[model samples]
Target: MGWFSNAPTANRIQNTNTIAACVALLEANGQVLNEVNTFASNQINRGQQLSAQAFSVQGAGSQLGRELQAAIGSLGALKTNTSQQLDELGQLCHNMELLIQQFDVPRGARTINASGRDIARVAVHDTSLVLANLLVLEQNSRPDIVRSVQTIDRADTVLNQGNANQAGLNLPGMNFRFQ
Candidate 1:
């Protein structure tokens, strides 16, 4: 009968320990989520920069392509290389988004202890905020990649057309031999 009296105390101690462990886990998860988000965002920024460079090259090639058709061939190859890299970057962003989704942030909305619950809430809130920012970065950067691909494709088309047109013309300085 005396041992039975200590049962409630033991259960309370166990519950408190469980809550503390949960709080620690949530805090650690929040930190990891932040690190992952930062990495993903940085990769996205780099992808955007690469996309811009591709655009610049495409612009210059487009302007110069009218005069020197041979330059278009080399510039078009460069454009292809950059566009492929952008596609890989986009895939990486997608994988990062999926990885972030797998992290199960604990919800403490119904916990009875106000202070522990508040800590859990803040951790969960912070992780969610970081996730949102990552999602925004991903969404925004994806469009740039798409647009870059489209532009590069258009440039390729123009370059091909120019090459075809040049094939039939016999410019004074350039010799045309078709096999």
Candidate 2:
């Protein structure tokens, strides 16, 4: 059921198989992180375009423009956070791969003790499952997030085109962040 649960059911082969399963999960996690980064980059690009439009308009000093600027600032923060997450994920995957390699190699230069290996096995088993679940949730919710950003773009377009009375209707403040 979990990411490291692909190992053998029998006790004799459990240790080696569990290490293999952890390596598999870490590899899959790298792929998943790449996908997440692509989606995040697209969103950041959209925000950049919107920000430029907001700055270029004649109504740049208007309340709408200010709000849009703030929203885009938030988007910038999201981009920064996304970048940090990518770095962390990369480091984590690299460390885990190294650990897995060391665990499998006997008389290797970077060898971990038996107790350390046991602890790592438990940690990777639990945490990898949690990470996989969160990635799935993020993937499932991405479409909705993209559509919502598109809706915001359309609203900005209408405001810029003077199709709506910006003075009469107030745009509600909205904040979006990924947990």
Candidate 3:
């Protein structure tokens, strides 16, 4: 077959199939990122509430309270960063979706001059770039999630200790309970 020889319909179908597969994978990744974002937001909110409770105690300026405050602050920052990462992932997926929609399968005489290979090449490149960025997002965000969880655990422990210490003080005009 010559350079412009008749390419089989199977070639175009395979190329379109590859592009479709990449789009599906990227869309799935976007969804997972969204779920992670929601979880991080909830964790951040709880951390902030824990910080407030920590400061309400008489020993608000103590080491434990200070640690809780720091952890809560980090969680807020983590949420912000994770949101940005998720947005990037969403955009990548959206672009792939558009590309896949425009991708066409050559039929009949058009197969002789098919550009499916070129389109598939571009799709593959886009997929690779998205995959690399997704890896980075996963690697970086994992540490933040782990750290946030650990901080929450520590804050919970401190709150438990503080509440136990002040269990039955029955101070006048002051009623605070950490749950």
Candidate 4:
């Protein structure tokens, strides 16, 4: 005969389900974090491009020149926001990972009581919330960057027009173009 009753089996099943759910949540969070990181990198690259263009047209005091400056400023703002959001996401991920590790600790017996079940339930809930928040942050940050980039492009277009008109006057282009 088995040393324990069917209660142990039930507890084992519950524990298994809890662990599975937590692992799934963690994996989803990981994917979102990766996407956020990729988006942040692209934002940085775009910011750098805007900065370089601004520097190229630094001396020319025209509407297009001012537009270029504004574009650079917007990009700087986006970078700052993205960096802050990423830091928060990283911290959340770290905390979730630690919680999962704690759940994975070996138990003395298979008879999971109410306390163990409660802990597992709480961990699962926390992980889900973290994942949700991460997704929301990523979605919000993306659109902000997109809007900023669009503005920058519009400014660049106006600046390019100025560059074309000033071709004969030897005014600097928005960027250094070796002709």
Comparing 2 with 3 on TM-score, the higher-scoring candidate is 3
Question: Which regions in candidate 2 have their CA more than 4 angstroms from the true location?
Answer: 1-12, 107-110, 115-151, 159-179
Candidate 1 lDDT by residue in tens digits, 81-157 = 43443444444445334333322122232223233334334434544444454344444444443443344444444
lDDT of 3 at 137: 60
Q: Candidate 4: where are CA atoms >4 Å away? A: 1-8, 58-114, 152-179
Top TM-score hit: 3
lDDT of each: 0.38, 0.51, 0.60, 0.51
lDDT of 4 at 50: 50
lDDT of 4 by residue, 33-71 (tens): 555445445544654565466557665454544554555
Candidate 1 has its poorest 10 consecutive residues by lDDT at 170-179
lDDT comparing candidate 1 with the true structure: 0.38
Please list the Cα RMSD from the true structure of every candidate, rounded to 1 decimal place: 17.8, 8.9, 11.3, 11.1
On the 0 to 100 scale, the lDDT of residue 36 in model 2 is 49
Judged by lDDT relative to the true structure, which candidate is superior, 2 or 4?
A: 4
Candidate 2 — which pairs collide?
none
- List clashing residue pairs in candidate 4: none
Off by over 4 Å in 3: 1-8, 105-114, 161-179
Q: Per-residue lDDT for 47-156 in model 2, tens only?
A: 55555666676456755445555555554454454456556666666776666665544423345544334736764665465465446545554444444455446555
